[model samples]
Target: MKPTTSEMEILQVLWEKKSCSVREVHESLNKKDVGYTTTLKLMQIMLEKGLVVRDSSSRSHIYTANITEEQTQTSFLDKMIDTVYHGSTSRLVMQALGHSNTSKEELAAIREYLETLEKS
Candidate 1:
């Protein structure tokens, strides 16, 4: 599913908070200066996009992510590396490593990720 920028923002919030009501989503979004109705409307549209689903049986409609975070990340990163990194994941990794200070734990996690990749 191709999410517009607004949809992506809403998805990011939903991913962080897990299940949430429209009011809760609105409040969290308003903290970022987005209007409440706008957030509500975007979430409604996101449902159409198949990125979110809402249950109305609850006190407030509890919204849940219909797409997994891994799926979203993989899709976005494929686009990102193709566009931003000019199709070079090696360049992306080199730049990320060179430009950012990765913590020891983060480095260990990266190593573990690479180890799993090698096994596959």
Candidate 2:
């Protein structure tokens, strides 16, 4: 399942830490300007949403991602491609290539990518 924006914020920290209690998650988020209770409720809601799994063996529930980082990114990219890029990966690639300060090596890599696509 995909997390909402707020929950995704918490999930990012959880992914980085591997596992963390609510307080640790809250403290990590506090560094990014989010409130403690807000992070708590967000994670609590995420637990209900099955975006995270909480270990209840301790007095404080320790949370871990039910979804891996790759799955999360793939989901996000799918949505963004469908919505923002009109389901066109080429459009996304073109936009990125045009927008960024890509080096010659990066351009050569992209050319190689296109050649591989053609060969396939």
Q: TM-score for every candidate vs. truth?
A: 0.79, 0.83
Report clash pairs, candidate 1: none
Top candidate on lDDT is: 2
Q: Residue-wise lDDT of candidate 1 within 16-112, one digit each (tens)? A: 9998988887777766667778888888888887899989996778999899889988998999999999999999999998999999999999999
Residue 53, model 1, lDDT: 91
lDDT of 2 by residue, 1-120 (tens): 777777787889989999999999888777566667777888888888888999999899899988888999999999999999999998998898889999999899989988998999
lDDT of each: 0.86, 0.87
Off by over 4 Å in 2: 31-33, 108-120
**In the order shown, what is each candidate's alpha-carbon RMSD?**
2.3, 2.2
The candidate 2 region of ten consecutive residues with least summed lDDT is 29-38
